[model samples]
Target: MNDQPLSGLTVIDFSTLLPGPLATLMLAEAGATVIKIERPGGEDMRFFPPKSGDVGTLYAMLNRGKRCLELDLKAADARARILELTDAADIVVEQFRPGVMARLGLGADELCARNPRLIHCSITGFGQSGPRAMEAGHDLNYMALTGLLALSRGSFDAPVLPPAQFADIGGGSFPAVINILLALLQRDRTGKGSRLDIAMCDAMFTFALFAQAQLTTLGHAPKNGADLLTGASPRYRLYPAADGHLIAVGALEDKFWQALCDAVELPDLHRDDRRDSEACAAAMAERIASRTAAEWVPVLAGADCCATPLATLEDAFRDPHFLERGLFDFTADADDTPIPATIVPIDRAFRGRAGAIDPD
Candidate 1:
C-alpha cells in the first residue's frame, strides 16, 4: 500500500515567500508532485541573506522536494504554458495581490474554467474582495490588524515582535493546505472544483479566543500582561534564573502549582496566589533568581511541575528527546550537502522516506 496520501497529485505553486511555499512544501512532503513556478530571476526569497552556494537556505528549505520552472508570466508564451500546466494540475496555489493574477490572465476563474477540476487556492493578507485586499502588508501587519499583537504587549514603550510568523504560517499556509485538501475531497465526491480565498488576517482572530471570551464577559479584554496566561499569574509565566536563563512555568492547575511552589520552597504566605497575584509572582521570581538554571534543573526534574528551563535554538537542535524521536531524520540537499529538513506536523507513517531527497 502507498504510504504517501497525495501520491499521484500535482501542485502548481506560484507563492514567493513563506505562506504559499510552506503550504506547497507540506503537500510535497505528503508525496504530491509540486512544481514551483518562479519569475525570470526567481522569487525575492531566493536572494535573501544567508545563502547556501547559489540558493538561499530559507528558500532551499521551503522548496525542497519540488520541481522548479522559470517563466515571465506577463509574456504570452508563459501564460500559454501555465494554462497547459493547469490542464493537468490537481491544485494551484498562489500568493499574489487581489487583481494581480487576474490581470495576468492566470486567475482562478480562468484556470478553473479551463480544467474544471483544479483546486485553486489564493493566499493573501486581507482577502480577495476586501477594501484592504490591494494594500501591502506582511505577517506583523496582519497580526496588528487582527488584535492578536495587543494581547501580549512587551511593555508600555513598545510591543513585542513575535519570534515566528504566526499569521503567515498559522493563518495563511495552514488554512490554505486544509482548504485545499477539503476541496480535493469535495471534488472527488462531485466532479467539480472550487476556488479558495485564504485571508491571513481573517484566521488570526481565532488565536484571540481567550481575549474574546474576556471581552464578551466583561465588555473589554484584559489589558496586556494582565491576562492569566499572559504573565498575570505566577504559575503561568517565565522566570529568570540567576544565570539569566529563563524558565517557562506552566503550572496552571492546583496540583502542578503546589508541586512548583514546594519545589521552589516558596513561602506559605505567597503560596495562595489568589490573595495577591503580584506579590506572589514577585516572591516566585526572587526564588527562581536565587539559583542558576543548572542548579534548579534537578530539583524541578522530579517535581512533576510543568516548569522547564528555556532551551535556546542551538540547545533544542541538539536535544536528546527530539533526536530520539527522529525529528531530523530527513535531510534536504543544499549545494549537494545534506541539511536537516524542516519538519512539518505530518505523521511519519504518511510521510516520504526518511533519507529521500527531492529528485532533480
Candidate 2:
C-alpha cells in the first residue's frame, strides 16, 4: 500500500447517493483519504431499506472506505469546519445544483483559491451554464434528455427502465474520476488547481455514438429494437429457450454468424440475414426455442459463435472466470460481518490493502 497511486492525497466529498459516492469510493480504494461530509442526520441513503445490521447495504458498499463527518453546512460552525478542511484537501467533490455551493460561500473558486493545488470536481445533471442546469433531474431524466433512452426501448405502450444507472455511473461518476485524475496531473506540472464540470447528460451522448453515426449518414433515426446492435439482426439478440431461460447471441461477424446458422440448422434463405432480417430472426428464434438453454450450451460452447445462456445475478456471482480473477477479494464490513465489497474497475496494482478504511 506504500506505493498506492493516491497515497498522499485527501478528498473532501460533499456529495451523496450513487454517482458522487461511487466516484469517491474509487478514490478511497486508490488510497486517497476521503472524508465524506454529510448532514446532521446523515445522507438519506444511510436510511435506505435492505439494511445489513444498522447500515444500508448500498450505503455501506458505496462508502466502504471513506470516513464520515456529520455537518450541517448551513450552520456557521459547519461552514468554518469545511473551509478548514478545504485549505488542506487535495480534491473536493460536490453534487449540488448550480449556485448552491457559491451561495454557501464554499464554491470551487473559493475552495481552490484556498488550496492552490486542489482538484475541484462538480457533478450535476446538466452543465453549470446550460438552460437545464438548475432543473431537477435524475439518472432516467438525464438519459431521456440525451436520446439514449429512445435507442433501446420496450413495447409501444410502455418503455423499459434501464437495468442499471448508466447515466449516473458511466456519465457522471466515470467522467468526474477521469477528469479529477487528469487535473491532478495538470496540477503537478502547472502548480495550480482546476475545476471540472461533469454534467451527467453531457456524457450520455457518447453512449449513442453508433446511433448518432447512423442518423448523420442516413438522415434517419433508427427505430427502437430495430437497429443492428439493438435487436434487429439474428446475430445479436436474446432468444427464449424451452425452459423459459434466455440465450444471448452475439454472432456479429460473418464467421460467427455462419457458425450460429450451422448450429441452428437455419434454412439457406435465412442464412443471408441481410437479405431478409425479419425472416432470418424468426427462423433463428424457432430453432433456439426448441431446446433448453442447458441443452444448447455445449453445442454452442465449442462453436465459437458467441452464443450463450443469459445468466441471472446469482449465476454471475458464482461465475468461475470472475472468481479466478480475484474480483471479490476485497471485503466490506456490515456490522462486523465481512461481505464482498463492491467490485471496482481499478487494477490490483493501484489499489490499497483490503478493508483499508475504518468502518466505524
Candidate 3:
C-alpha cells in the first residue's frame, strides 16, 4: 500500500508545455490522480529532441504518473466529452492564450457553474486579461519582462539568459501549486471553489526578490553583475582553478572570509574591502588558478568559507552525498520497463524507497 499527501484528489489537466504540466506533475507525485488531456497527436514537447527511442525523455519525465486521453477539442463531440469530464474533476489546469478556453466553452465562469466546487486554474504567458495576453513567448521572453534577465551578465551591452527557466517553473508552476493548495484549504471553510489566473510574466517578476529589493531601497535597478550575490563580491563567487576546474566560494561573513583568507595564506586580503575590487578579483582568480580544484577542495572544505568545488550535472549523480540522501532510484513502466528518476525533496519517512509515494 502507498501513502501520499494528496491521495484522493483528482486533477483534470488541459495545460501543456512546462509550467502547467510541471505543477500537475508535482501533484501527481504526491498521488493525486491527474488526467492528462492531449491532442489527437500529442504534446508540443513530443517534437522535442533528445528522445529515448520513440518516447521523449522530457515528456516521460514530466508526465510519468498520468493517464493521457487523446481528444480534438475543436470537434463538437470531444468538447462535450471534456465538459462532462470537468464535472467530475476537483481541479482543472489549462494553459492557453486568453479567450481560447472561453471560445471552447470551458471558460472559468461557466466551468464553476457546472461544478460549484471545482478549482479552475488558468495558466497563461501574459494573463487572461492584459496588454501582452495574446503575445507568444518562451521561457527567455518571460524572464525578460520580469527583470530577472537583468541579473545575469549581458554582452557588455545586452542581457543574457540565466542558467534556468526562472519564470516558467519557478514563478508559474510553483505559484500555481501554492494557490491551488491554498484554495483547497479555503474550500474546507467556504465550501466553494475559486478561479486562479496565473500569468507567467507576472509570476517571474516576483522571483526577483533581491533585485526588486535593490530597486526599492537603493533608488534604481542593479546593473549586470553589480549586485551582492551576482559576482559583485569576491567573497561570494566562482573562481577558476589551476586545472581549469571551478571553486565556488561563499565566504560572506567576516568570520568566514577571515577563515578563507587564512586557509589560502593570503592574510593581506583579510580586510582589504576598499581596494580596486576589479583588480583584486583578477588577482584572486589567478591565485585560485595556481592550484588544481581537487587540491583546494579539502583546503576549502576545512575552512569556514562555505566553499566547495563546482560540480558538473552528471557528476552530481555520482556524488556520495546525494546518493546517501536517496536522490535517485528505479521505477518501472506499465510494461515492466525500468526507469531512472531523481527523488523530489521531502522528509525521508514520508516516502517509500526511491521516493515512491501513494496518497493513501
Candidate 4:
C-alpha cells in the first residue's frame, strides 16, 4: 500500500496536454490511483516537439505513476467502459469542448447520478455555458482574451508565447485539481457530488489580481512594462548582461529597496522616491550591461535584495536551493531510460508555506 496522503483515492483522467496531465500527476505523486485514458492513437502530447530521438520527454514526465489505456472515446464501447471506470472513481477530469461530454451521455449530471460521491471536473477554453464555449483556443488565445498577455508583452513588434502555460495548465488544470479536492472534503459532510466547470479564459482573468486592484483603486490600468511591478520602477525590472544574459530585480519593499541601493553603492537612491526613475533605470541598465552573468550573480546573492541572474531551463535544474529542497526527481522508464521529473514541493513541515495542502 502507498503511504501518501491520497493513497486510496482513484482518479479517472480523460484530459490531454500539459494542464490536465500535470494536475493528475500531482495527485499521482500523492499516491492516488490515476488512470490516464488516452485516445486510440496515443496521448496528444506524445507528438509534441523536442522528442528524445523518438520519445516525448514531456509526455513521459507528466504521465509518470499512471497507467495509460487506449480507447476510442467516440465509440459506444468506449463510453460504456468510461462510465464503468468513472463509477468507481473518486474524481473525473475531462478537458474537452463543453457539449462533447453531454453528447456522449457522460455529462456531470449523468455521472453524478451514477456515482453520488464523485467529483466531476470539466476544463475547457471557455465555460460550459458561455457564448464562446465552442470556439477553440490555446494558452495564448486565452491570455489575449483576458488581457494577461500584456503582463509579459515585450518591446519587439512581434508577439511571443509566454514561457509558462499560464492559461491551460495554470488556470484550467490546477484550478480543477484544487476544486475537486475541495469537493471531496465537502462530500464528507454533504454526502453528495458536484460538477466544476473550469474555463481557461475565465481563469486567465484571476491572474491580474494586483493589476485589477490597481485599476479599481487608481482608476487607470498601466500598460506593458509601464506599471510599477511591471518594470516602470528601477527596482523591479530585468537588466541585460554584457554577455546577453539577464538579471531580474525586484527590490520592492522599502527595506529591500534600501538594501539593493546599498549593495549597488547608490545609497542616494533611497532618498528619491520620485527621482527621475527613467534616468535611474537607464543608468542601472547600463551598469548591469557592463558585466557578464558570472560576475554579478554572487554580488546579488550576497545582497539579499531580491535580484538574481536569470538562468536557462537546463541550467536552472542545477540551482542549489531547488536541489536541496528536492524540487527535481529522477525516474526510470519501462526501458530503464532516465526520466527527470519535477517533484511537488509538499513536505512534512509545509504548514508554514502559504499554499501548502492541508493534512487531514
Candidate 5:
C-alpha cells in the first residue's frame, strides 16, 4: 500500500515551464498520480539549453515522476479528452491567462460543473479580473511590479534581477499547492470542490510584509536595500572573504551577534551603534577580509555563530546535509544516465520515496 498522504489521488496538470509544473511536482512527490498534458510539440521548457539529449535539464528535474501526454486543447477531441480526465481527477492545475481556459471551454466553471469534487487551480501572472490580468510577464516582471525587486535594488541605478524565480516559485507554485491542499480539506467538509484563482503578483504581497511593517509603524517607506533585512544592518548582511568568496552572516539575535563578533575578533561590533550601520559594516568587512571563506567556516562553527559560506550551485547540490538526507536521489536523464532529481520540501515521514518514478 502507498502510505503517502496524497496516495490514491489523481492530479491533471496543464502547467508548463516552472510554476504549475513545480506545484504538481510536489503533489506527485507526495504520491499523487500526476498526468501532465503537454502541447503538440511539448512545452517550451523542453528546448531550454543544457539538454541531456533532447530534454532540457531543467525540464527533467522539475517534471520527474509525472506521466506525459500530448494534447492540442484547441481541438474538440482534445477538450473531450480533458473533460474525461477531469471526471477522474481530484485536482486540476493550469497556468494560462484568465480567459484562455474559458475560450477553450476548460475553465473552472465548465470543468467543475462536470466534476463537483474537482479542485480547479488557475495560476496566472495577475489574476482573472484585473487591469494587468492580460499583461505579458515572466518572473522578473512579476518581481518588478511587486516591489520586491525595488527592495533588492539597494539604491542602485537599475533594478537587479534576483538569481531565483521568487515570484514564479514562491508566489505561484507554493501558494497554488497550499490553496489546493486547503481546498481539498474543505471538500471533505462541504463535499464540494472550489476554484482557486492564484495571482502570482498578488501572492508577492506576503513577502513584502516586513517592508510594509516599516512603512506602517515608522510612517517611512523602506528605500531600496535600506531595510533591516535588506543588507542595511551590519548584523544581517553578506561579507566578502579574503579569497573573493562571500559569507552570509545572519547574526540577527544578540547572542548570535556576540558570537559572530567574538569569532571575527571584533568585539566592538557587539555594541549598539544605533544609526551607523555603514561604519559597523565597514569594520565587519575589514575583519572578515582578513581570512578566506574556507578558513572561516570552522572558526564560525567553533563560535556557534549563524554564519556560513555562500555556496555555489554545484557545491549546494553536494552539501553534506542534503546528501545525508538523500535529497539528491535521481532517476535517469534523457541519455539514460542518472541525474539528480529535485526533492519536495516535505518531511521524510510523509514522503513517498527518494527517487523519481520512470515516466510510463
Candidate 6:
C-alpha cells in the first residue's frame, strides 16, 4: 500500500510568501508533486532576511521538496507555457489579487474551461468579489479587518501583533488545503472540478465564533483584551516567572484550577466569578514571579494542572515529544545536508517519517 495519500497528484503553485506556499507544502508532504512557478527574479520572499547561502531561510524552508520554474507571465510565450502546463496539472494554487490572473489570461475560468478536471484555488486577503478584494494587505491587515487583532491586544493602547501569522496560516493556508482536498474528493465522484475562493479575512471571522455568540446571543460585544479566552479569565493566561520566562497557565476547568491553586499555594486565587478575574490574575502573576520557570513547571506538572513553561523556537525544535514522534526527521538535500522541517498535522499512520527536501 502507498503511504503517501497524494502521491500521484501534481500541483502547479503560483504563490509567494506564506499562505499559499504553506498549503502547497502540506500537499507536497502528503506526496504531491509541487511545481512552484516563479517570476523573473523569483518571489519577493526569496529576498527576505536571514539567508542560507543566497536563498532566504524562510523561502528555503517553505519551498523545500518543490520543483521551481521561472516564467514571465506578462510575456505571451510564458502565458502559453502556463496553459500547456495546466493541461496536464491536477491542481493550480495562486495568490494574486482579484483581477490580476484574469488580466494575465490565467484565471480559473480560462484554465478550468481548458482542463475541466483542474482544481483552481485562489488565496487572497479580502475575497474575489468584495469591495476590498483588490486592496493591498498582509496578515496583520487581515487580522485587524476581521476583528481578530482586537482580541489579541495588550492592556495598553497599542495593539500587539501576534507571534505568528494567524490569518496567513490559520485562515488562508489551512482553509485552502481543507477545501482543495474536499474538492478533489468531489471531483472523484462527479468527474468535475471546482474553484476555491479562499479569502483570508473572511476565514478569520470563524476564529471569532465565541465573540460573535456573545454579541448576537447575549447582545454583548466582547471588549478588546477582556474576552473569556483573551486574558479576561485568570485560569487561562500566561504568568511571568522570576527569570523573565513566561509560563502558560491553562487550568480552565474547576479541577485543574483547584489543582493549580493548591500546587502554587494560592488557594485564594481559585475564583469562579468574572468580577474577581483581574485580582486573581494579579495574585497569580505575583505568585508566579516568586519562582523560576524551571522550578514551577515540574510543580505544576505534579499537580496535573495544564501549565507549562514557554518554549523558544530552538527549544521547541529539540523538544522530546516532537522528537519521539519523529517530526523533524527530514530527508537530506542533494548536498546530503539535513533540512529541518515540521510535520503536517495528520494521523501518524499516514505520515512519512522522513522530511522532504529540495535538491541542492
- Which pairs clash in model 3? 3-358, 4-358, 4-359
Give the higher-lDDT candidate: 2 or 6: 2
Candidate 3 C-alpha error for residue 285, in Å: 2.1
Measured with C-alpha atoms, the lDDT of residue 276 in candidate 1 is: 90
TM-score, each model?
0.96, 0.97, 0.92, 0.90, 0.94, 0.92
For candidate 1, lDDT tens digit of each residue in 1-360?
255899999999999889999999999888888988998978888878788887787887888888888888988688889988989999999999988888999888899999999999999999998789899999999999988888896997876888999999999999999999999899999989999999999988998888889999999987877788887889999999999999999999999999999999999999999999889999999999999999999999989899999999999989999999999898877778777787888777778853322433
Better of 2 and 6 by TM-score: 2
Question: Model 4: which ten-residue window has the lowest total lDDT?
Answer: 351-360
> Positional deviation of 222 in candidate 6, in angstroms?
1.6
TM-score of 6: 0.92
lDDT of 6 by residue, 1-360 (tens): 255898889999999999999999888878788889998888898888866566666776777778888888998698889998898999999999988999888899999999999999999998898789889999989988888788767767665778988899998999999999999999999999899999999878898988888889889768887777887788888899999999998888889988888888885634544667777788888889999999997898899989999999899888999889777775424234455664566565555443434431
Error of 5 at 124 (Å): 0.3
> How many angstroms is residue 3 displaced in model 2 relative to the true structure, after the best TM-score fit?
1.0
lDDT of each: 0.89, 0.89, 0.78, 0.77, 0.85, 0.84
Candidate 6's C-alpha runs over 4 A off are: 1-3, 268-275, 331-337, 346-348, 351-360
lDDT of 4 at 266: 62
Score residue 277 of candidate 2 by CA lDDT.
86
**Residues 1-360, candidate 5, lDDT per residue (tens digit)?**
298999999999999999999999889888888999989988899889888777787888788778888889988699889989999999999998888888898888899999999999999999888899999999888988987778877445655568888899999999999999999899999999999999999878888889989888999768888888887788888899999999999999989988888888885743553657677788889999999999999999899889999998899888999788777664535556567776668666776643442443
In angstroms, give how far residue 324 of model 4 lies from its true place: 1.9
What shift in Å separates residue 245 of candidate 1 from its native position after superposition?
Answer: 1.1
Better of 4 and 5 by lDDT: 5
RMSD, candidate 1, Å:
1.7
Q: lDDT by residue for model 3 over 1-360, one digit each (tens)? A: 167777778899988878898898777777678888889888887567656556565666667677788788889797789888889889999998888888888888888999999999998878888788899998888887777777875666665657877778877888898899899999989999999999888877677778889899988978878877887888888999989899998888889977877787764853465476676666667778889999998888888578889999899989999888667753524223445643444345443332222111
Worst 10 residues of 5 by lDDT: 351-360
Global CA lDDT computed for model 2? 0.89
| RMSD of each predicted structure | 1.7, 1.3, 3.1, 4.8, 2.0, 2.4
